[model samples]
Target: MSVDNSKDLMMIDNGEGDEPLSQRQLNPIFASVLEARLARRQVLKGSMGAAMLGFLGVGLAGCKSDSDSDEPVTDPGTEQPPVEQPPAELLGFKAVSVSSADQIVVPEGYSHAVIIPWGTPISGALPAFSLASTGEDQADQVGNHHDGMHFYPIDGSSTDGLLVLNHEYIEPRFMHLSAAGQSLGSGGVPAFDAQVGRPVDEVLKEINAHGVSIVRIAKAQDGSWEVVQSPFNRRITGLTRMELTGPVRGSDFVKTLYSPQGTATRGTLNNCGSGPTPWGTYMAAEENWAGYFRNGATETNPAPREHARYGVPSANGRYGWELAADGSDRFVRFDASENGASAETDYRNEPNCFGWMVEIDPFDPDSTPKKRTALGRFGHEGVVFAPVTEGQPVVCYSGDDSRFEYIYKFVSAGTYNAATADGSLLDEGTLYVARFNEDGTGTWLPLVYGENGLHEDNGFYSQADVLVNTRTAADFLGATPMDRPEWGAVDPANGDVYFTLTNNSRRTEEQVNAANPRAANLHGHIIRWAEQDANHAATSFEWDIFLKGGDSGESGVATNIGYDPKGDRLDADNVLSSPDGLWIDPDSRVWIQMDSGATDPFGNCAMLVADPNTGTVKRFLVGPISNEITGITMTPDQRTLFINVQHPGSGTSGAEFAAGNYVSRWPDFDDSLPPRSSTVVIWKDDGGVVGS
Candidate 1:
């Protein structure tokens, strides 16, 4: 049977509806606001039926429908300008319309080029790229499905820099090189059956395809960017050795046969979003790492709660990797079963070694990646640090990417030292989870042991246990559960932190809170908060909705579920949905990227620019069909913008590929060769600041 691209490619929630995580009730004030908003929406639905509502360009309460009339209810040109305009720096960019094109569509006067593709060689002797390349060949080449990325300037020059990118996941239909009529056993064919194990070679190739890649890119004399092979180029794959640092280092929860002391592990998987530190290191987050392991339910000594909480099935692994063990410890490590007498004799604890903020020194090719555990472990979408002060403690914020998960913050115990501070600063810190009160007030509840029932009386025995099982500790403290929280961006001008609450389809009306208003929030929204006294280290905060993403033609009354709507929606550009990736440049301009599915009517996923101060958003660029526009970064001078087009023809099936009915053949646009995810660089035709 062929894979279903629509259901398979989308984000999976393996731990859905296991247990209630939050015990605290929603804030009454916020609950009242939601009640009133829903009441008004009901009244509107009663007064104006679906047909009349569409003509008025007003969206129905819970569903979306096409409007019969193309004309706007009120021409935007007739409205008077606001008394106070946004800063002059935020204006002047022409908005691009939503599109389903096979190319990257940017505003007029801007140009883009595919700089680095999945098979590009970055180090040693340049190797030719072909689908027929062996697993060893891809082990030395670029990985697949480019997600988050950053640009580190070389010698402080914008013209030359190191580009670091994360290989989020792989699309098997395009990765393997099979003969014209080969029976798909392995060799790149995806194995979905538990009885049928993948070929060891195919598994090895996939293992080499799931980590981070760093390459040097430079601007040519023609002002276009090109990948240059340099000594700094390196690839950190799933087989790479990684050190486990911070409080959980050498803990009993992480001890395994490979590393009895638990100080190290092999590989970083599902690296999604990332953050660059002030100390010149890259922090990559490991998301969705649980599915890789398999724990049999029939084990005589089973750890069901542990496996269930992390969403690892007891019967079979997500990819059936353990079936290819073949007496090798490398492959057997994925089998988290009680084959051995004790946990230390098997790989039962291997899953605990992942799901962390891994720190890698991009400048040092030989540096060891450290998993900073004091930041607390969950399904971390990414970690974004607040602007560092000379003497203040470094503060980092992260969001758990599961539906109804909590947002977290970590304040380092040590003060900033520009000359010598490194990942050690992250070793000792206060890991706090957010508790958003109903009255627009929030508090950061510490997850430290013995502070709030996080002691021996509860399941947590020490701080390490609290850090290891962060979700349970947060749940014990009644932290507020939120919609699927994804990437976070910290504003440079102000200390305000913004997070993208990517939509939650499983969230019901009763589960809706002040922060997550919509019952079934299909089109996600962005939420921003300012720490008390403008200090990121503070335990309290004040927040408000920044933007509500939906159809621009939605009625004002129906859309007024959050903050005031005077300047919220960007009607001219039709904005976007499912806001997944976000970045704030040095100039304080907010860049928003989308990861909506194929069903979205606003066309394919796109990127937008937002004025945080004025809450004004405009579409800057739209990606190709079925591709997610992610990994936003810019040059030091802010002249060039880099973004990743992930899985362009994402929902394509293996049978479809064999039958020549693929969804998209992007980047190359050549039907002869399979499409590949790549990094594209955008720059103004005339040398001006991007979005200026």
Candidate 2:
């Protein structure tokens, strides 16, 4: 559904001595299921009543309306008849959510297998993965957790491309030493590690496993996708060197012992959902970046106030990398210290190196990654740009992947010139925070200088301060804090922005408001926005909830579930929850991927699809036991879909081996092969549109 961009001017900040949405109880009329369902029905069809949804003084008539002209209207107290379900097949193949296996199960015509797994050597120089591999193999090869990824076509090559995948995190057991090829923790420590106060080598290996990998893939004449051996298969891990770009480059906040000018940093960490820029660069977001350091109870940097804003607690050394060499000095420097002699001479600036958007040129392996620090740092899940418009500012949206965090956008300072082939134009941009108003309109608050009290004693002293303490700056500006925002994608047919707010457990009823309306949001929702006048870089927009995840049969279904593309409202019976990775396919089909870990009744994580226009959502595929379905990218031809099955045996520990039950023995078809984390491609046997 399209948004009414003409309604962007009525935004009101809560800072005008007015009660915050958190303070006011929801209006009883809007809170009713009948009202909410009606509102949602209107939302699904892309329209809302002038009186009810005109909160932001928006022109309700301007919204694209879903004409429920054919369906029989029912009373509020009555139930609607079930709509006819689509034939349960994807390209003539029945798609089933495999329940009893640790594998990707498909119907009669489809087959799946892994081309590469943990510890697999990318090149001859890289050591092969030992059956009982140590952390060393992890450094030289792929890491354990294979999550979100992208498939890029080779120049002039069709049906053949390089798959750039993300290894989100480490599986210490499989990565390190263990008898059954997996160990939770070792009974002994190496001599070098014992003296360092940290697992030095192990830490370094884990560090090296956290980035992206490029593997050449080719489609057989039979339509099956497989990896092709080539030297182009390369790994860009956490230890790989990267360059800093944008306004924050060489800023004092990012300067560290490694690169005093802050022009460079060691590597990317916790790389999650990714974006392929129109200019051909890959944008990898660093998520949960706050947990990587160890400072042990007090500020390591001399500046304590600044360190506090980034969630760098002195006593939180959970990673324990600091126990290695020089304990607190070598490893602790990454802890976001406040006890450094000075900002210029210490590692207090490390946290600033992360949370910003990092861009890599997959075509140019030797190119250094550029951290576009202008995209204010937080737990960035993914970045999705609007289609590039010639001579217009390049616009992109991102979500801060934390409970109550905010959504953001970066608009290039220079207008994009399609004729100009260089992608470097992304280096300069104006970042803005979203402000959703009670009146149904919104505004983008500038995160630049000379505005929003950014350069003064407004808790910041300079441009660097605003960029470094972005969250605090955003808070002061009264930006709307969403419910665990994750990935976002723009509609190819229209400019509407689609983003997922993965479940936020911290919110309570007291915090419930219109925009984010759940307490302990176990079932997350998707919020979509359209730019003013359909312009990518417009400072205003219109927004609404697109889909709500939960049991399709629950009571909240009536109040919580919005419209799916099928022209039916979601009920409490379907068990999809925690909507995470999102992508708008070439045909504008909204693909919704779930990362169900803590609260899943659906058994395992799965991939789902929704036709946003009619609000119709359907289960597409589910992963095997103990794995999350992530990193989905379709081939340029749109017939093949590549997905990552990460850590299928993740929770399995060495102690559990003695038991008859294993967390999972995944990718196990013949049962002779040891389970390995890998990427899988889903395509039609006859070679047609993936979800047909």
Every model's TM-score: 0.86, 0.82
What's the C-alpha lDDT at position 382 in model 1?
87
Give the alpha-carbon lDDT of every model. Answer: 0.75, 0.65
Give the per-residue lDDT of model 1 (tens digit) for 244-290. 99989988888999999989999998889999998878988888777
Which whole-number lDDT from 0 to 100 does residue 20 have in model 1? Answer: 20
Q: Candidate 1 versus the native: TM-score?
A: 0.86
Across 227-274, the per-residue lDDT of candidate 2 in tens digits comes to 677877778887778898777788777888778878998788888888
